[model samples]
Target: MKKVKHTVKLLGALVSSVVILSACGNAEGIYDDKGQVFRKVITQDMSSLDTAKVTDNVSFDKFNQVYEGLYTAGKSDKVEPGVATGEPEVTNGGKTWTIHLRKNAKWSNGDPVTAHDFEFAWKRVLDPNTAAEYAYIMYDLKNAEAVNMGKKDVNTLGVKALDDYTLRFELTKPIPYYKEMLAFGTFLPQNEKIVKKYGERYGTSEDKSVYNGPFKVKDWAVEDKIILVKNNEYWDKQAVKLDKVNYKVLKDSQAGASLYDTESVDDTTITSEQVEKYKDDVALKKRIMPATFYLKLNQGQVPELKNQHMRLALAQAINKEDYVNSVLNNGSAVTDGFTAKGTADAPNGKDFTSQIKSPLKYDVKKAKENYEKAKKELGKDKFTMTLNTDDTPSSKISAEFIKSQIETTLPGITIKIKQFPFKQRIAREQSENYEISLSGWAPDYPDPMTFLKIMTTGNTSNNTGWGNKKYDELLKKANGELLQNAEARNQTLIEAEELLLNEAPVAPIYQKGEAHLTNPQVKGLHYHNMGGDTSLKYTYIDKSIDRKTGKKKTK
Candidate 1:
């Protein structure tokens, strides 16, 4: 493992006791030296940079800068070329894909990036010993399931390195959206040598990983600041204007906002309260993210949650509008269905809400009646449930609001809120140890199937244990027969989603919106719809220009 040292500046700490600091003033801005672009992002702690095991947005955002996948999402949320030079060619009726890589790409260590790196990375992720949370994301690849379950040797996996720059993939079926899946982080390559050198420490911290993308990690201390510097070995280095990127870890929104206000940081997201104060600022910008915040009922932990009436009552008891407008004051919009609006390529090119029955609107009368029916069905004198959430300020507020609403709307129903740190909350969620869990989903790709297919019976992400055999059948059909026919595939997906909503396995809440402030001098910063790090490959600070040479330089 290569350890890179960096200088850091201490930002103010919050009451939560998390280390908040900035990583600027190192090597004097890359833009100042070489006319490169740079961005300063504010985030909570970055748990890890291992793409396969990463779940938090903060970690993913930073990791994205340090890695690249075969495909990537473009400005229009459509599939675009990344490491690969062009779109993959389907040779055997979509079951087999041939990918031609760009010869010029290289890793940060100057090693030629090749197809073999992908093959090695995919096999490592699916190995049962890896225990990656997103392993199921690749189960569509031929033999991936068998390999993951230890029924097949890793050598039998579908991906193959035909040569130094040519790769092939065999899919279990003809999936039209398969190209979109390749854009996900799990598909990013890993340096086998680096992994072997670090062994157990591989990807546990910043020192253990190597860069193969737009940036490289530097000066990363857990719960503190992590810095990213541009990869000069990148194939498109000439196009990448960013020299150095800095991230400040601050859990409190107020403290983060203060950093942005004082010009100590380049950009930071704002809460609802801060939105009102900063909306008029010239730097404020709004982005509609493809995320759905919802509640997960743990039927395994609480039997009452298994009862259909209790689930329906609980769904109706909370007011989504109030939650979005009051609790999440930052521009979030209440969603009538699980999928957010504006998501492209939906069934019939229509929003998911358009195809579903009217959602369980907020009605105390309906909630109370259902609560009574639940008590009667359970044959209990009283019913009690606990809601689990992360200890973040936004999560705490959201949990408390739901608790108050449920207690006030439904009589004889007692609810408790349990707050845990982010790590503990993730552990409990994975173990199914909570009666109810507050969770959110940010799309890994552009397609609706990414969000819709996770509820299947055997999916690793289906920790809620919510499964419908018919829904699974529809998804399989979509992945196999209907995928090549886009229209047919979308219709099948619509049916699957309708079934999911009718079952009410997960209560849909609202589509999230982000409020953030950026320095006006920061030019060419692009926002990614998928919740990864913002890309600055084409960005640069527009300092004064050289009049004779038509060149720009930092002022």
Candidate 2:
């Protein structure tokens, strides 16, 4: 199954430790040689540049810079044409779409960016042996599911290259956001020649990948630094102003922010602990990311989590409002459902959050009552569970908060906290090595299925081993037969969420909000609440702006 933009697991857990590096030929927030060079610190290192293999937001961010798909996320989250001329022409009752690609588009290696590139990329990912974790994201394509499950041949897959510049896709159902889905990283076209040559080394380093997007990898010093230079051979090179994009993989937020203070970098996301220091600073920027930071209770590891009352008690024991306003202090939105607000909308075109009642709201009395019932059911008055989290400052704080809340509300319940590095935590989650884990997910697309599909029985992304047949059936129906009726589909999704929350396989704590410091000269560094998080394609530096005065300079 597809992993969350896992934003915008650790979207709230931003930055890990830093190896302070000198400026990359930049002066006063501007590159000395090429003023368009943009420098910033990233939360994590890019896992892979191979579009088929990536399962994290950090990789997705770099993918956005180096690849172009049928569609791309423009500034302000607007959908714009990348290789394709525009949206596809709907036919065969909206199941089949024919897209016209830009004939002039070429990869960094000078190969024509053709329809076959996309077809090859899609088929490669759906191939069962490829073992792509995000193969489910492309399940909307006809036969994509069967192909990924090893039940069908890759050639039978719905996507086809009609010619050199035109591509066609046959969907299992008519998807209204199908155009937007193509803009996703999984859908980005890959160079067939480069993949064949590089083999296992493909996209592992700067030399192994070719780009058709605005930038190409200039240098990649894994876990140290990554530098992307503008793709001169790109179809629309004029639109890309930045000559270089520099990213330093840092573990701590304060070190990054300090670099920003020294005018060595452009922007850095501040940690929760540092929020107090920059609460009133002029350069401080805050945004409530559309993401859910939640607890994934591993029923397989801890048999008690399988109990509905135990899950309910855990859900009700915490005060979400206090956690958001006090602990986070970054304008995070509180919700009881897995699907974050502004993620999807109802058939009536209203916010989905507005139409439903939150089933997991906090109530100490309910928590206590449920706790007693859980104790009786288990015939135990005392229990202990370990909570897993990353080593980031934010993750540490959140773990302590949850441990306190559960232990305080339910007496005799001992909670142990264990921390691992960011990637190590994901490894433990996949292996089911802990009782409870604090993780997060951001939408890959603007649909309920993006969030809902993870929890279905046996989805790899479903770190929690909790599954209910009814909940799975509801999602299947909503995304299947109910696609024709938006209202009915919305209702079905809502029911599924309510049912799942009653079991609390993964109880949501709060929507993630980001607090950071950005250079005044930086413009169009858009942070998306949905898929891709942020794209640097439209991000440019305005040299006319004075660094200190926050005003444009004039002759």
Candidate 3:
């Protein structure tokens, strides 16, 4: 890979303001009680900010604010050009893309961001040694899979820099969603010089990285708080109104709600208990995210999980509607399919979920019959299993609910709930260390492939230890050979999803709908379902509005 000219510049002291800049005009910080510029609570501390390596959403919350990709997600999660001046010039029957990068884009260090940076970043992720979990996302690139699998060298990847400001990409097939994929974190560019300078330390701390996005990390106190100040060098900094955004880590929702009530934070997520308490509050809000929560049964730990009857029995025993409406009074809804509803609309404007027949439902009789069959096959009168979940208040409550439901429905099962911190829980699940683990997935992109492809054979996110050769073949055809045929690809993905639900490797629980509170003084805080975590660029604290009434305060 060719290296671009690297320049390092000193970052002088950032101008301090006790109050926000004139952009907020006469308005004061809504959470100004703490002398904060802007404030919000993160449910979990960030895991990593390295775009190429980080996999969790909290880490993405930081990464998405500090990095800009060739394309950026716009309002409503549409793909918009960022570093790239416009949509790529396509040729070779959609197999080749020529992107003209904006020459004005510069790194936080005043180094010019160029096409070579993208080439370097893409190849770095594709390098097997990087161990990036999202490496499979780039498999559409010619030789990407081969390179990541060690069958070919990283240099053989189909991306190249035509010059300082132009990039070319060669694809294995015509991906209609290719532009949207570019907006994802894995495709974001990195300054080769900074990466090489920091090596292992890159992105580990606030100052260890270079930023090209709307905001840069000012300070990060691990597990306590992260401070982000506006990046003046960003290409679109003119639109960034907030001088700073502070993310404080708070895992307890009740504590967060109390803070929100006292105006200590600008935003906080609420638990089911608080949902009814704040139901009449004018600031209470709800949003349905393009995310799904599920149970990952570790077939590797318990071979009985591999039995269709056993898996179905467990899935059928849970009353999903009651779980959503009663247990989780949040905006969540019961989902019968793995892919959440409203995620994708078919060609005729019908929802994708509407086209499929769900194999999952709450039927105690069916569950008992299946359980009997499973017991007969395994020759076991009773068994004890562990249910693993995160330590958050909501996770604990939900885990307890699930345990009660399952044990009551299935006569011979004893469930013990084991709780770990969010990050630790993810690690345990990734290692396939538990019998049944509660898991959730927020799609990296809008396409169904983001949700569907995770279950493919050997995919990193498939912690269930489930695989079907036919399922893999169908997905391969949907994403590759049938890439250009929308009708064919849709049907193929539908078939694959049906097979997955029928096998019940992982049981779909609910699509996430967050019922939370936001300070009315904070404006322009948008929830983008298909994009990276919300950026504070356009968000501002408008103190002129009455906090309780959400109306303009009159003198």
Candidate 4:
């Protein structure tokens, strides 16, 4: 990682608006009522802005606006063109993808964005020294896994830039969701010169990198605020409605709602308390997010957690039904599996949740029996474990509730709650530094594999240090031999999840249901349950709202 001096400074005037691929891609036409400012509240501090290193939703949202990938996730999760010209030319039974880059796409620094940028960025994610946690997401690419494992050269990865505009990549197998995968922040392009120049410091600040998307970073103050202004050099600048995007960090959901009530922010994700307060409010939109929050036992970090009896005891001690109903007043519901409820459909046209049956439940008697067995095995009469979670109000409440439940149900067990800022909590989890951590996953794609693959033996995301050979074998078949057979693949995933849950590697808590108080005037705010939270590029404030001073806005 050494500094490079060659910055692609393509000195010229701005280009015309780039061509959008399809109608469902977005709402076409300039907005007459679009406001100059759009304000929003975030629950956590950003982790990273570099596409190769970004793993959090907040950073992913920023990455989506500042750096264009080969494709963009459009309205209703539709695959939309970003730097890509149009639909890619597929060949070799979908194993190969040949895409043409839009020549008009330019970075904020006036560099003509080229295929080479994508080639460098993808390879960088796999570079051993870079230590990218999401590199496993690209394991579908030929030689990508081997490169990340340090067994093969990164250049051997089956991706190439035929020229300035043409980019091609070969997959080890036909990925049905390849187009959707390309829309992820991990695949976003980067300027090699800027990256090499910044070295390890890339994405830490605003000036370290350049932007090629709808907006550019005007300023970024760590844990304080991030201000993004319109990227006039962007190819689709004309279509970008907001002149400025303001993201303020407010971990307290109640404070966020207060901001919304005061009209200081256009949107805020409310907590369960606020959900109850705004039960009849029209502005409070309840959505069952395509995400799951669960309890993960760190087998490597704690020896007792490796015991099936202890794990089962931990899993069965807490009542998910009560937790979701009382603790999470949001639209969340008890979940038995890690895969979300609405993510993918099974062969019988049911969601993955309805198909998997696990033995996990909140039975006080069975939980006590398992604890006795664990104590017998460990030769200990008493045990204590720490529960790690984010410092957000919602997470703190969840942890406290879980702690109280587990301690009351199991006589000799004590639970300690360790709260860290969101990003620090993620860092500690990835490093396997906690006993039992409250973890959540929002799917990167619509497929069941997006939820299932994270539990693979050596995956960077498998922070639990829980692994099963049989589980891995089923996933292997699902990804390989069953790629063509949808029914078989679906069944395989169900079986895999059942096996994993029954073993108590992790306890399925609840599927998140987000309740957000949004200004009625916010229009075309492209949002999905997965990936980034929202695309500010498409969001516009259409009109003013005179919110009631002290109560939830009913209008």
Over 1-555, each residue of candidate 1 has an lDDT whose tens digit, in order, gives 001000011222343223223223433532123444354545467777777677667677776678888887666556789899998989887789999999988888888889998998999999998888788888889999999999999899999999989999998877766787787788888888888788768888767887878888876866656777888888887777777777755556666666555455667787676788876677777777778777888787888777877887888889889988877777788764676665554545666546656346677788788888888899984778898987656666678788888888887778898988777777788888888888778777666767887788867666776778899999888777776677787778778877776666777778888788776667777677774746666667654643223356446
Candidate 4: which pairs clash?
A: none
- Worst 10 contiguous positions by lDDT, candidate 1: 1-10
Error (Å) of candidate 4 at residue 358 is 1.5
Report each candidate's C-alpha RMSD, comma-separated, in the order given. Answer: 6.4, 4.9, 9.1, 10.8
User: How large an RMSD does model 3 have?
Assistant: 9.1
What ranking emerges by TM-score with the best candidate at the front?
3, 2, 4, 1
Question: What do the candidate models score in CA lDDT, each in turn?
Answer: 0.74, 0.83, 0.82, 0.82
- Point out the higher-scoring one by TM-score: 1 or 3: 3
User: How many residue pairs of model 1 clash at the backbone?
Assistant: 3
How many clashing pairs per prediction, in order? 3, 7, 0, 0
**For candidate 4, lDDT tens digit of each residue in 434-461?**
8889988898887888988899898788
TM-score for each candidate, following the candidate numbering: 0.89, 0.92, 0.93, 0.91
Question: How far is 319's C-alpha from truth in model 4 (Å)?
Answer: 1.8
Across 1-555, the per-residue lDDT of candidate 2 in tens digits comes to 012213313443332212233454334332233568888887678778899987777788788889999998877667889999977899999899999999899999899999999999999999998889889999989999999999999999999999999999899988888887888899999989999999888998989989999999988987778888899999999878888898877666667776776677788887655678877777788887778889888989888888888888898889898888766777687888788888887878887867666657888999899989999999888888999897765566777778889899988788899988777787788778888988888888888888889999988789788888999999999888998888788889989888888878887889888887888888877777656677887789898887655688877
Report the lDDT tens digits of candidate 3 across residue range 360-448. Answer: 77889988999999999999969888999987666777887888888999988998999888878888887788899998888777677
TM-score of model number 2 = 0.92
Better of 1 and 2 by TM-score: 2
